[model samples]
Target chain A: MRDRINALARLVPVWAVWLGYGWVAPWLIYRGATGGLGAEPIKALERELGEIALQLLIIGLCLTPLRRYLGVNLLRFRRAIGLLAFSYVCLHLAVWLFLDVQDAGRIWADIVKRPYVTVGMVAFVLMIPLALTSNDRAVRWLGARWRRLHRLTYAVAVLGVVHFIWLSKGFQIEPLAYLAVIFALLALRLPDSKSLERRTR
Target chain B: MANRWKNDLRARDVTPEAVYLDRRQVIAGAAGLGLVGTGRAARAKVPEPNAWEDITSYNNYYEFGTDKGDPARHAHRLTVQPWSLRIDGLVDRPGDYDFADIMARMTIEERIYRFRCVEAWSMVVPWNGFELADLLDMAGVQAGAKYVAFETVLRPEEMPGVRYPVLDWPYVEGLRLDEALHPLTIMATGIYGRDIPNQNGAPLRLVVPWKYGFKSIKSVVRITLTDTEPPTSWNKANPREYGFYSNVNPEVDHPRWSQATERRIGGGLFARREPTLMFNGYADEVAGLYAGMDLKTYF
Candidate 1:
């Protein structure tokens, strides 16, 4: 009973994350809906969904580092956070597909011809299997292979950053900064790289 | 949605009549160059007059920066004095025309028109310039010429965006011979009865009211009469999103955005969207130019 309470308490921060900016995409979007999204509402909405998805992906990537250094075991919430990221990614693409690009032929042309759209589509494709196999049944069925399959998250994160960089016009530092942080987070996951590991409780 | 406008702003020319008369002479000498067909076709019906801040500050001259607000902030660094225009390629007379010489030969007139961005934002602007057809005639277009290509100045030191590959350096745009010869095509030099600000393509710029705003290349330095179609900057960068013939077709949507409707720039977030018009409401004047051609296929 005591262990159950402790586990529930640890998950509070996770719930906060699920409700906070790291995962509170729907809520933020709801706010934009109520107040209005500026002159070009559809464009603004499309960009917001894409940006929130990126931030959620970054936060999802940081879970391993949190466990390694701060001893905050967020592993329990990783699946939920990842699925949220995927949902946002799907939503982002949906907005672009349905509301923004109404012409079917143009949509195909954009996905095939534009480098930025191609990269973004590739990233979204990489997330589909991860989201589909996220349930306990798939985990139990695949066992060890599930971990291997889910490892594709690393590549998905990298592609997401690339998509952002390519879409931006001019030499913007914000997307570049996201790239740097993502690289650092991935580097921390290296097998022998334990420089930041906490020594004691 | 027609382009025919009946606005009070035309009645209020902020410039004094004395100076207005002095400037009016620029257009007086030109033979048979009437202010493009707004009266005959009566297409555009623009609503509110954009505020001075919106007119001067809100611009998208990507050579200055990609952001709409960046041009007004960054374009001041550009030098417009002693500018020259190169009129060449498939022409009888091909040479560098000094800014003073070009202005001397051209007729300037006020043109209040609806300006629409492919991003689906719209604005109304009053511009002063001469018919581009006059300049094309002055260059003596060869019969073999089938297109008119325009190139913007590339000053990396002054235009910071040029330093980065936001787009190809020296922005280039083109129009078919028939489209280029259209009466609505003007090379704008001023706005609101004053010399155009540097951000709004000071000295000179192309204004094709019937096409997407990007078709109106800014800070123009080169005008070439070409026998073949020319590659445009945005179309070259992302051909899927921006077509070479970026005529304001309400039916053909952009790859990632809708062209059916537009948000008026100053209309606030929740304002009703104004329906987009075919050829930006200049359909009466330009629809025949694309007869038998499928805009969607070319688009």
Candidate 2:
């Protein structure tokens, strides 16, 4: 079954996956323009894009655990997943900046004054380095340093979830659920004492 | 039907059907002139009432759900017929007043007032209803009454959002006796010459124009005249975020978002947010009510 899964994963191109996922933003924009996104289309579109970006980040986080525990070696597509998440995050920020909040001074004020926006901006800023280094040349040049830099993803994911939770009015379950899943994924990555001792020996 | 007040805003002042239909063009024209965030000088003109679709579809009634569209989707289950408002506490005539009976006694009129939400979004609504003061007079407000408390209908089977504790169930709101008695305050029964849709607080709802939208509680079921301050749903949920005196003050921002500017609903995709007015542009009418009081601390 594992071999079959690996073969199936190889059959699909990473660029195809990228293109498929990339189509969502334009589709949402189309929906917004056509009045399909309901009364508050700008807010709806902004939230949907943010949610999609978070979901993509969650998917990217799952790759390591899936490969380690279940022998689902989909490591080849990790770069594509990371870059897609980054792209979606940029799109989400763009929508918020251009459509939802059109004022330049207010945008800067929000980032500085609002804690949720600050956290969201921090997460977006962190993703920039990871996205820039996703290329093969950067990976080869950075060597061991590349993996260390990419570990920033965990912090970015946690901050993203925190931002969502903080931004939501009242106590909402959806953002809390994201918080739980991200924590569990991070927990799975923790090195067991025995494994650590063995590796040191 | 009218005793004293005159309509300041007319039906023609409502957003034109042509403008509403061709909002994209208007938005583009506005954007080209860099008019999106020009500040308070540009906001002097009276706000145009949003289209019927925008007013009905976009709402913050959490009884149906938290999402803006949730009320429109789930409010169909709400049964507004055979409704009665329980008017109790410091009143001479206190009983389960039937909805139709109340309507017959009160004089309803069109009150085109600016509606601002605490979330920094706004609309101009032409509410058809009578002054709440008139209703209080009929009930015979006792001298001891200091506050007017309101409660929304709580039908778990009907209101799906009630299943979750988004707010204290049976959403409650309150106003100071003077604030409640203010001529600007009305119990709206209809919108734009039609009975309000179930999603937009059907049958009867308090419409306190100068305060935030949530202060004008929807789908009201009870109104209690009391001496002590009453607990409001949002204030109870998060006092830091929401206050008992949730007046629309542009200077006093909500903890989460800015209240200085508001996005006008139905302004199309690229529309700029206009600066919010003090007391939602009704300060001239209602400002004297809060004389010498600290709005920032109260907010």
Task: Write one digit per residue (lDDT tens) for candidate 1, span B1-299.
Answer: 11223433463534344643343243233214775344223324425345555577677787777666689889889999989999999999999999889888787777777899887788878888888888889889999999999999998899987766767788899999888877788889988777999999988999999899989999899999999999998888887778888989889877655688786764332334668989887897788988898999877
State the lDDT of candidate 2 residue by residue for B1-299, as single tens digits: 24446667666776665666676566557767997566224444656677778889998888788889999999999999989989999999998999999999999888888889888888888889999998888888999999999999999999888787777788999999999988889999998788999999988999998899999999899999999999998999898999999999989988878899988877555557888889888888889989999999888
Q: What is the TM-score of chain A in candidate 1?
A: 0.84
Clashes of 1: 7
Q: After superposition, how far is residue A78 of candidate 2 from its true place, in Å?
A: 1.6
Q: lDDT per residue, candidate 1, A1-201, as tens digits?
A: 545654775867656655654445565556544434533455666788898888888888998997776666667778878988998898889877866665688689788876779889999999999999999999999999999999899999899999989877545666898999999999888866344354331
lDDT of 1 at B39: 25
In angstroms, the error of model 1 at B182 is 1.1
Top model number, TM-score: 2
TM-score of chain B of each: 0.85, 0.90
Off by over 4 Å in 2: B1-3, B15-44
